[model samples]
Target: MQSLFERIDRLNGKYNALVSLDRPRALQRAREADLAQARGQSWGPLHGVPITVKDSFRTAGLRTTAGYAPLRDSVPDRDADAVARLKNAGAIVIGKSNCAPLCSDLQTRNDIFGTTGNPWEAGRTAGGSSGGEAAAVALGLSPLGLGSDSGGSIRVPASYCGVYGFKPSIGKIARDGLIPPLGDPAREDSLTVVGAIARSVRDLALSYSILSGEPYGIDAAPQHAPRIAWTGEFPRQLMDDEVSSALEAAYRTLSDSGASVEKVEPPLDLHFLNFKYFMLNMYEFSPRESSPGLHKLFWLFESARSVFSGGIEANYKKLKADQREQVDLFDRFAQQFDCWALPATPTAAFHHQKSGRPIPIRHRGKSKRYSYWHATGGFAFLANFLGCPSVAIPIGRDRNGLPIGIQVVGRREQDTALLRTAAHIAERIGSTMPLAT
Candidate 1:
């Protein structure tokens, strides 16, 4: 506990990864934990282990702003359900990590804590709104962090920082006290999920169990080769050479390890699915109310597309059927394949840029201008749209030495099995944890 505090004191200023810390309170709890241990008392698996949470999660007595100004001094008297579960499992929160203001943006920056720099490159972006959580985990400031993902928040940041992140099936982790809540909590089902970002898959598994009430099957190795399904490339998505090559190399490793890897296209149209995502997000999230320019324009474009395709009512029925098809098709997919493999994002971490601007994507003399969405799209939303489980595993790095990663997805409610498959692959391909140096 002292070591973690010392490291944060020494390095957090440089990274701005941690926004609010409860050092005094945390240290007291740590000492109490030590005394309990001395008396042979065990809190749980994570007893006395220090960890950090995304600032968006309300931690009892700890200030949580979600990077919004009005809530700067806000302190909740109760923990978010997921946060309480972590605390119940003996995970001590040393601090709260930074996030995008009100958890609205894709990059981590706000008036409260400035911006979170990528652990690999200071000038590049740390993906958000879970950016600070990933940066902290990667830089050894924290071993594990809780992140919320309605979009690509968890996986994108983990890929950017060369760490592991997991998003379990919808409602796998309770979501009562999250700031800028995405889905309607009154309902039992969810489109958003609370998940874990960690330096290793084992930590993610433990955290998942604590959060979801699942088994803590640590070091779960698949007994046989996994039947893997992957798109050689997603249709119409432009990717950097480095990112593409790294993924292809990972496929080679999985194949060499005896996995039956097959190239296949996504079962549904991606553009259509993305439109479904935007349509549903309109009601579930409120980011667009604050977002200007492109945010509004994207909504307008999708709305127009809906009208162009007959009408919203017509598409609503189509989408409802599509949702059912998503369930049925994926059930059969789960029977045939252990997991689906794909890149977490289209490119490796790029230099920090504004959200509405065009990004220059270049590789081996090929250069093109891409919108922010095109550049950041890593096929991540597929899992979110389908309510599937997804895990981002760092496989290699780009020429600029930034990390590259791929997400393996599993059927809804099969998070533990997917994680085990990921662990099996990690064991075969070797540990990809970034040196916190």
Candidate 2:
């Protein structure tokens, strides 16, 4: 544990992966764990493992800002449910990792902490809002990290950093003490989920079981090969050659491994689903309070309903309806296939740029401006929208040597099954491809 801290101290400056360190307390806990072992007391599964939590999760006595300026010095009186679970399992919290501002942006950078860089490529983004967690684990700073996913936050970073990230079905893990708290209205949208990012699939399963208060055997692989469904493209989505090729290779490998592989088209229109997701996200992120004077002005602005799309309440209703339809479609599809495999992202990690600027990409032999979120979240948004479990695993690298990932998605509330499938795929892929060092 001490050696891990020393390595973090040495590499943090270059990666900017961690925002706050609780080294003294962590070392003290490590000593206590060692003494407990010496006394012949049964230690927990994590034992003395050192792990980092995303800045958005409130850690007791440790500053958690969620990349917001207002909470820069705010320390919580109690740890978030996930954090407490890891601690009870004997894992020592070493520090808080960087995240997107208010967990809103696609890239991890804010006024409180600077940008986190990709460990594989110096100038490229690490991916966010869980960018720090993924980069830290990929660089060997920590073996495991806890991150939150809302609209691809966990999967995108894991894909970019060449690590494993898993998002369980909604309500599987308790969501308490998370910053930018998901209050009643946000719950209606139901997009955010706390998840884990790790260097290995087994570590992901271990940490997930601990956090979710589930047992180890729940994620065990099936005795026989499982049926898998896959697709290389989605409606109105474009993929870089490298990403498309890696996904194809993964499908071929799974087929060769005795898994029943089938190519299938998604039931719903992806572009329309993405639109509903965007509307709901905007409504959830919208400010709730306003000054009296501004309130009247805002009311007048809202009164012009025809000019604007709709009110937040109306958008929420439409989002709920869309969600139900999408869920039903996925449920029917899941009845036939055990899991669906897709590209984690359309492109590999790109050069770091300021948020809100259009990123240029080559598609169909032409240059085009791509929204960062649209590029990373196109395939990922479906899982969150339908409230299903999804796992991202590193498949191989692109022509430029950047990592590419494939996501295995399962039916709602079938997180363990999803993890088991992910483990099988990871074993096959890891044997053939060398992961990012």
Off by over 4 Å in 1: 182-189, 218-223, 292-318, 363-365
For candidate 1, lDDT tens digit of each residue in 1-437?
Answer: 89888888888887889999999999999999999999999999899988899999999999998888778899999999998998898989999999987666678998888989988887889898899999999899998899998878899999989999999998788878988753343323346789999987888898999898988875665577777898757676677778888888888888887878898877667776776676555535645434657467865776787877877556656666776776787777667888888888888887888775766777545998777766774377778778999999888888888888888899888899898888876776534765555
lDDT of 2 by residue, 44-68 (tens): 8999899999999999999998888
lDDT of each: 0.82, 0.82
* Global Cα lDDT for candidate 1: 0.82
| Positional deviation of residue 350's Cα in model 1 after best superposition, in angstroms | 0.9
